[model samples]
Target: MKALVVYESMFGNTQQIAQAVAAGLGKHVEVEVTEVGLAPDEISAELDLLVVGAPTHAFGMSRASTRADAVKQAPGGTIVSTGRGVREWLEAVHPGGVGTMVAAFDTRVRAPLPGSAAHKVAKALQRLSFPEVSDPETFWVKDSTGPLKDGELERAERWGADLGLLVNSR
Candidate 1:
């Protein structure tokens, strides 16, 4: 199966997780890892699985409040939309029988408590009719900049491998 891993990272913590996911998935199937700023039109329709990840902000997926404070960010309407990285990528595709295998994951700081980016991205994917949706996953970090805590990358790898198995079974 062909898989794509897209991610938005501020201090490279999320990117590391994305790479780990790609590595784990690559062990079982062909995978492509890319930054989330890819043009919507650039998204390939032939992909069998789409995995998206981002850092959580403002108790949700990069909501507008968190994004706007940085610049004119916000992929969608919220920081979650911050340029619509995950939203646009999924939206740009015309998933037929196989796109239903989409999965979502997110990275967040484990302090003061907040939301998960995976939930936001998963919800967005579901709205577009991606079937057999897997549960959203969360990876914790030490602080805002994030060292990713412990065993997070290993967990990401496991998630990737498991997700690959799910798509391959379909």
Candidate 2:
């Protein structure tokens, strides 16, 4: 089955998790992974699964205000960091019931945990009518810029494997 994994990353931690998930999915089925902004219309209903990811910022998904501020302050919105790309990409998906299974994942600092990006993404997927929505996955980071504590990547791999099984069986 064809699958796609798309992610938004800051400090590259979420990107690493996206890669690990893609590698795990690659072991069992064909998969393509890309930064959320780089994804093209190649995604279609024929795709069996889609995984979306982002890094949690300021207790919520990144805001357009932040993006707007960055654009104003910097030439290309380079300085403002956000997880909004996943939401933006979701909006861009071909809209009338694409029939693809979807799952979401997010990376966040462990302390002062306000909420999760994965949960937010999952809810959004439900709104979009993704056929079967899986539980959101979360990975922990010790500092704002993280090395991912320990075993986080391995856990992400395991989640990917499990996700593959769930989608295949359905």
* TM-scores, each model vs. reference: 0.80, 0.84
Reference-based lDDT, residue 40, model 1:
39
Model 1: per-residue Cα lDDT at residue 29? 79
Which residue pairs clash within candidate 2? none
Candidate 2 wrong stretches, greater than 4 Å: 64-84, 95-98
Q: For candidate 2, which ten residues in a row score worst on lDDT?
A: 74-83
Q: How close is candidate 1 to the true structure, as a TM-score?
A: 0.80
In model 1, where is the ten-residue run with the lowest total lDDT?
A: 73-82
The runs of at least 3 residues in candidate 1 whose Cα sits more than 4 Å from the true structure, single-residue gaps closed, are 63-65, 68-100, 112-114
lDDT of 1 at 95: 53
Model 1 lDDT per residue over 10-59, tens place: 66778889989998889787999877766334445677878888877777
Per residue, candidate 2 scores C-alpha lDDT tens digits across 57-111 of 6665655664454345443534423544776777776633467888999988888
Residue 62 of model 2 has an lDDT of 55
Alpha carbon lDDT of residue 20, candidate 2? 92
- Clashes counted in candidate 2 amount to 0
